[model samples]
Target: MRRIVPVLALGAGLSLALSGCFVNPLESITENLVEEGVEELIEGQTGVDIDVNGSGISLPDSWPSELPVPSEGTLQYSASIGETFSAQYEVSGRGTFDDLVSKLEAAGFENTGEIEYGGLTSTALETERWQVSIVYIDGEDSTPAALQYSIVDKDAP
Candidate 1:
């Protein structure tokens, strides 16, 4: 666990710092790299068989394949339908959320503020092609922090 975390962090740092290398024509590969990296990390670290397309959640027949997932987290669940993708993940490390915010801001995503409903908190962001929201509950007592992420293709309906 200890060794894997540093490798994950290093991969994420490189991915963010050199993100443009995977832009445009190679965009879909970026998503593949992200998913594959996570799977490898989990398998190497915890011996868990992480599934790529095995989330088993219902999805649209034609969902895009370019959506990225976090490289250093445990995916609890995932689903896709229409032009939307949604997932729950157990993030490790203290600044994982902050790193996400920084990456999104660097990508020119507008932070449209936050929303609270039904005892859950969400931070919303928007880009030309994607609208994203991360809903979470901060840890308290014996409960650990829980996070859910949703992304939608803004151009699709």
Candidate 2:
């Protein structure tokens, strides 16, 4: 009987662990490859550098000095979208990545994809010609932050 109990317990634990492997809607939206690719594209076009440490993405020296100051728990970065350029930053806060998603949705930004990079989960959003991203730091008290960049087009009709 004791052996059976241990076996059952082990099986139950394995089941629970496996159940968590299912893709969550929020996770799906928070860690996307497409968004990462877009970010890379923007960085390449603007010649702006990005250094994403565990804390957040560091702003490059070439960044404009007049960018808005991020909230206490937020970090911001600049990038280019298509033709019109913009700045993107991240807002880190109390709640986990889930909280950031709620705030973004509340702010009228739609979830696009999920991106897992540098041991963090980044949620991506876009508005017409702009691309924004928010990354959730796993075990820190830092607030969620976003990446805001613009798209530039010289020949617009």
Candidate 3:
């Protein structure tokens, strides 16, 4: 009878302890810390600030407010250096490269150049204050689609 109570207590304690594992499962605190440390190290080594959170990418505070950034893609990385800002994203169902292109044009960016070679496309654009580049990979069997965007201040010396 006394042994039964100990077993029941052990089981209850184990159930409570194991519940935490299920909630986070494979979540890695070390991975997050390493990623953050790498980002900070890169920022310190270079004059550029960078963000690599895959959940949602945002523009750096140093970026010019006149530029518009798309929110529909999984932001792999973002960088800001002086008057230049750039980002790379994995194209998800939420948004496509074409949608980003249209959004830029609608925001008053003029197309400066277009290039296509071997399923890759690059578009250069410019607004009154910024020069921008939009590059993307068309769908291929072996490679997932991705997009890149960059903007530089036209007047930055």
Candidate 4:
């Protein structure tokens, strides 16, 4: 019994020491590495970059070249549940949405259409690989406008 107790104590101590060493790598792979892999996978599948700043949603490549990012612009992972990723840039200047639309068109995107309701306008632009939406409240005193872009991999599990 004396020998068994010493062996068990040694085993337990060794396990505790070893566990600490292994946990960090496992955790690193699970959180940071996994998120990076997911970002790469999403970008590969959708051809849009994912920048999850942990704010709201991820932005696409070459966003807001001409348009200005609002002083309080938010870009992070999707806000709504079940949305893997999406991003929006808010602008407080006049004709912000129109400028964004023109930028998209110049980038080879076709103006798919526009939707209006409740004094708001949403213009959609599409390409072979992605879709972008510019939304703004019509006639609002603030002239607050937003550009929302998203890309989802249907094959992602």
The lDDT of each candidate is: 0.60, 0.44, 0.68, 0.50
Q: In model 2, which runs have C-alpha deviations exceeding 4 angstroms?
A: 1-71, 74-97, 115-119, 139-157
Q: Please, what are the lDDT tens digits per residue for candidate 3 over residues 1-157?
A: 6334433433343243223322353455654555566566656655567765444557788877766666576676677766777777777532576777787899898989999898688899888788999888765676567888888887987
**Candidate that scores best on lDDT:** 3
Top candidate on TM-score is 3
RMSD of each: 15.7, 18.1, 17.0, 17.5
**Candidate 1 local distance difference test against the native:** 0.60
For candidate 1, lDDT tens digit of each residue in 66-122? 544454566654544445666666665435566666677777889999877764577
TM-score of each: 0.52, 0.31, 0.70, 0.41
Question: Scored by Cα lDDT, where does model 4 land?
Answer: 0.50
Q: Candidate 3's error at 45, in angstroms?
A: 2.0
Model 3 error, position 90 (Å)? 1.3
Report the backbone clash tally of model 1: 1
Instruction: For residue 77, give model 1's deviation from the true position in Å.
Output: 0.2
Give the per-residue lDDT of model 4 (tens digit) for 42-90.
Answer: 4554443454334345444444343333344444233211222345565
The TM-score, computed over Cα atoms with residue i paired to residue i, of candidate 3 is 0.70
Which run of 10 residues does model 3 get worst, by summed lDDT? 13-22
